[model samples]
Each structure stands twice: as structure tokens, then as C-alpha cells.
Target: MEVTIIEDQFILKTKVFFNNQSLQYLKKITGSRALIVSDSIMETLGYLQEVIDYLQESGITSTVFTGVRPDPDVSIIADGLKLYRESGADVLVAIGGGSAIDTAKGILYFERKFESTEGKEMPKPLFIAIPSTSGTGSEVTDFSVITSEGEKVVIIDEFIAPDIAILDSTCIQHVPQRVVADTGIDVLVHAIEAYVSTKATDFTDALCEKSIKLIFENLETFFKDSKNTQARDRVLNASCIAGMAFTNTGLGINHSLAHAFGGTFHISHGRSNALLLDAVIEFNANLGGSADGYAADRYAKLAEVLKLPARTRREGTVNFMLALKRLKKSLKVEDNIRSLGINQSEFEDALEQLAETALLDRCTPTNPRQPSKQDLIRIYQKCY
Candidate 1:
């Protein structure tokens, strides 16, 4: 049992906050010239005022950029970059879910480039990502997903990773039930995928396993009663842990397939993850080779976490699919990619293009079981 796992190295520079009050300290530490990048939904949730008041209390100067949209596009990043330039922001504070954080990271990346070009060589803009929803782990990872011409492109660089991650349960208190459900699916996928990732190391594997257990135990509670503080805390922490895990261990078919679906159909990332997760798990289980046994064993562990029987490989495979079915039903999630408003004609129209784009996605090669072009198309068909 003392197997030495490979060490995956990444800069975990982000500090964390438990309660919302830590915003004051953040502003004080950063000397108050912060630009807040948030989405319309968060602005409506009164987080905007809460953040502003905290900043004002600390005598911090802040500007707001509320233009981020769901599944942020590259154009949004450009907009944020413009704001970052014009405002001369010293810190980039992100106060929402993955979308806001991803958008902010992209903006910060470009902001540094612009700043460096002007000979004003400032340190990379510091970012604090406060996740209002418990998914995507964008708060901690150096990875940012941006859409470009209907393709999900992942930007990875240490400079783009957030400097701090603030997890406040109160921020998630008013989130809709559907968001919690959908995002929980992403959390689960992150942990499972990281567990079996080809890049998995001891540090990431530990985080992934812990994340899987926490998500498995508390997701239902958080969904059933959104106000359950303990459940919400567990869920949010699990999401962050999974984020750190996958950032180093990386993701596999689940994310590649999700990115493909997200880019083509404009479905939310979590929903995309949910739709393709089981299918990819099944596909991977049947894949046999040098690493196949190790992969299958990890999948079996995942099955056990889901309370599915894992007595044998065959049983574990069956349980994985059945568990996904039960999970979708429990979460009131729909099957059929068509439900995402993607017509059959549209999918048929984009099959070849989707296959090509998915092959190019950053998350593809790190898959525990690599899929061929035909396999990718088949997976798409299965999800479809």
C-alpha cells in the first residue's frame, strides 16, 4: 500500500476565506484599487453591494465590470481587458462562478501583456475568485475555458491562476436549485476524472478521492435543502478540492466531450459534463491495455463511492451506468443531447467539425483511455 505516486507540480498561490467578512482584509492587503469582474446574475444577487460596502469600509477604490455572460466568450475577455486597462486596476477580484473567474483570468493574462509592453512591467494582476456556485473549480486552477468561434479553448499558464480563492456559503445561499444540481454534476465529474487521469499524482489523487467522498455524501443534502450550511460547505469545499486535483492531475474524456458539447450546443459546462460522464466511463472501462486495469480499478473505486456495487469489473461497469441514470433522475436532469435545444439536423450538420475540434481540445490527451476519431464520433452519437 506504500506505492509512491508521481508528484505533479503547480503553483497553488491562492489564499482562501471562510466567511464573507474576509473581503475587507483582501481589499486592505491589495491597497484598494480593485476591479470587480462579475456577471449579471451575481449583480442581481446583491453580492455587488456586499462587496462594495466591504471595499468602502476598508477605504478601497473599486470599479465594477458586470459584462461577463454564462459560458464566457473571447469577446467578453476583450471587454474585460479594456476595462482593466482604462481603470488601471491593481487587483482583479472575481465574485461569481466559473464564468466570471474564467473571464477575469483571460483579462488578467492580456492585461499583463499590455502592461509589460508599455514598460510599466507590473506584477501579474492578482485575482481572488469567490465562487458563488460549487463547481468548475476555476477559482484555484491555472486553466480558463473560453469560447472562440464556437470552440472551447483552454488557456493554461501560471500567471492566469487566481491569487486567492474565497469560499463563502452565504454567496451561494440564493442560488437556484437547478444551478446547484447542474454544478454538483460538474464537481462529481471533476473528482472522478481526476482520479483516473493519466496525469494523476499522489497529491492530486488524495484530493480527488476526498472530493469524491465529500461530494457523494453531501450533494443530495445540498440539493434537497439549499440552506443546509454544513452541506453547502462540504459541497463547496469538495468542488475547490476537485479543482486543485484536476488542475494538476488533469481531466480526460469527460471534459473533452463536455467541451465539445458545450462549444457546439452552447449547453452549460456542468450539464455537458453530466451528459457525457457516464458514457465516457463506460467507454473507458471496456478499453483494455497496459493502463486499462489501473483505470478500471479507479473506476471501481468511483463506483463504490456512488454506493454502486463494485465486486467485479463487469459489475462495476454496470453499476457506473445505472448510477448515472439514477443520478440524472434524482437531479431531475434530462437525457438526450437534443434536450439542450440541439436539433438532430444540427448535430448531423456539425459531426465532422465537432470531431475535429474535440481532437484539438486541451483536455483530450490527458485522458486515461484515449479515443480514436471514430470513438469520439461514437461517443458523440451515444450522448446524442
Candidate 2:
């Protein structure tokens, strides 16, 4: 194994300590005032009070910004940026899943460098992302995705990476099963895509492999029994690991399709990823030859890690489909895009736009196969 392959920098620098006790460490280093960005659901879940108490006990005041929504948009992030600037918060603490964390990232980014988006440097604020769910490892990565006019926009920079990530296992206790399923599948997609990505390196490959094994072994347990702390912890750790891997390696066609469709239709990102992942994987597999065979080998490795029956390329493809099928059934997730309330005409009309948007997405460049507009359309059609 080559320890030095290329000049690659994996800048997932967030210092994380799991379990509920990590809050004490967080309380110790936090400043006088921190902005806690979360959503209404999380606030109602009483996490806000718990965090506020922790802050107050440590003599650190906090300003709460609880307006974040699921699959957060640019407008929501802009609002968060305003709140962060007005509140004079020196530190930003995100206390939910991806939405809250993405919002916090955007807010902190805006505050540190560009007040008006006119003239600014490349860096931003020191952020702390504490995930309350077991997926969408926004806690660890410097990538933030926000929507604008039904298009997914991403901001990726090392400066946007959080200064700290506190993964309290207790946070995963009350997450709904649907969320677990959708985000868990997203985790799986991240791991698989990272392992096979053109940008994959030794560092990211290791993280991706470990994350795949963890998700394979524990995600079902989490879905079966939501209170299984050990399983939840494994899944949560895997989520962060996958995030680290994909942040460096980027994603593949699964993400490209998901971003395009979800952004256009207002569907959940994780669910969109889940629906398209298997289809994209199959499509990538059939393109044939050395590079394509390498992609198949990666999926075969993932299948073996998951203990699926994958000896040949065909078996590997079967394993991928079966595993995804089991996941969909276990989670009671629908298979088609139409089930998400997107009519046939809407999908057909948006097909060209989706193809264009996906082709232009940042993740598309890293895909093993650089698919064309026709390829994207065919992939989407297969998914439907």
C-alpha cells in the first residue's frame, strides 16, 4: 500500500468525543455566547433547554436560532447569517441533523469573511456541529448544501469544517424510524460512493471501508430497535466516517441524481439518494472494461462486507439490488419517484433540466463514468 499517493489533504479536523458526557468538554471550551442553530422540531424535543442549561451552568450565554427547516435552503441560511451577526456570537453550535448544521455553516461562513458577499477571502468561522441524528454527518465535514430555486448548491472549503464535533449518543435516542432509514441509506451510499470515487485515496478508502462495515452490521439493528444505543452509536460513528470519506473523495452518480431530483421536487435528500443509489450503481456497472470492472469490484467488496452473496460481477449487482430492496422494505420506503408526489408530466418536463443540473453538480466530475445528458435521462428513467 502506498502511504503517499498524491498531494491530498483530508481536512476533517473536528475534535469529537462520543457519549453524553462530551457536553462537559464542550461547556469547558465554549465562549461567553454561542449561537445554537436548530429547527423547531428539535427545539420542541427539549434539546434547546438542555443545551441552554449546559451553557448557563458554564457561565456561557447562548442565542437560539430555531428557524431552520429540513433540507435547508439559501433563504433559511441567509436568515441564520443575519441572526448570527446580530447576536454577536463568537462561536456557532449546531444541534440538529444536516439542516441545522448546514445552516450554522452558512451563517458562520457569512459572518467571518464576507458580510455582503461582495469582497471576501476563502476562510470563515470556527464552528461546532453536534449531531442529534445518526446520519448526514454534517458534524464532521466542511461541505454545506443549500437549495436555491429548486437547485442544490454546495459550498465546500476546509474553512467551513467545524472546529469540534460532539456526538452525544443520547441525541440519537428519539429519532424517528423513517429518518433513521432514509439517512442510514444515505450513509451507505456515501460509503460505497466514496470507496469507488475517482478521487478516492488511501485515507478516504480506509474511512469508507470502515463505515461500510459499520453500517452493514448495525443499521438494521437501529431500525429494528431504535433504543439500541450500541447500534445507534455505531451507525452515528459510521455516518461521520462516511462523511469524512465522501468529503475528501466526493460522491458519484447516486448523489448527482439525488441532488438534481430532490432540489427540483423538494423531496428529502436522503430519500432521493436512497431511491437512485442502486439504479446508478447498476448503470455504472454495465459500462464495462478495466475502470468499470474496478467499480464493480468496489461494490463487490461492499457486498462482502455486508455479508451479501457477491462472488462475480453479476452476483455483486444482485447483492446490491437485494440489499437495497431489503432496506426499502425494512424502512417501508417507496421505490419510485412518482410516489413522492411528482407526476409523470412533471418528471418528463424536468428530465432535461435534471440532467443539466446533475451534469453541472460538483459531485458529477468525480464520478467514475462521466455520464452525458442522455445517460442521465436513461438513469432517471430506470429509477422511475
Cα lDDT tens digits for candidate 1, 188-279: 88988888888887788788878988877888888889889889888999999999988887788788878877777778888888888767
Clashing pairs in 2: none
- Give me candidate 2's TM-score against the actual structure: 0.92
After superposition on all C-alphas, the RMSD of every candidate to the true structure, in Å, is: 3.7, 3.2
Residues 274-380, model 2: lDDT tens digits? 88976788777763344247677777777776778887866876686688788677788888877777789879999999999888888888887778999999889
Clashing pairs in 1: none
- Model 2 RMSD in Å is 3.2
Candidate 1, lDDT over the whole model: 0.81
Lowest lDDT sum, 10 consecutive residues, model 2, at 285-294
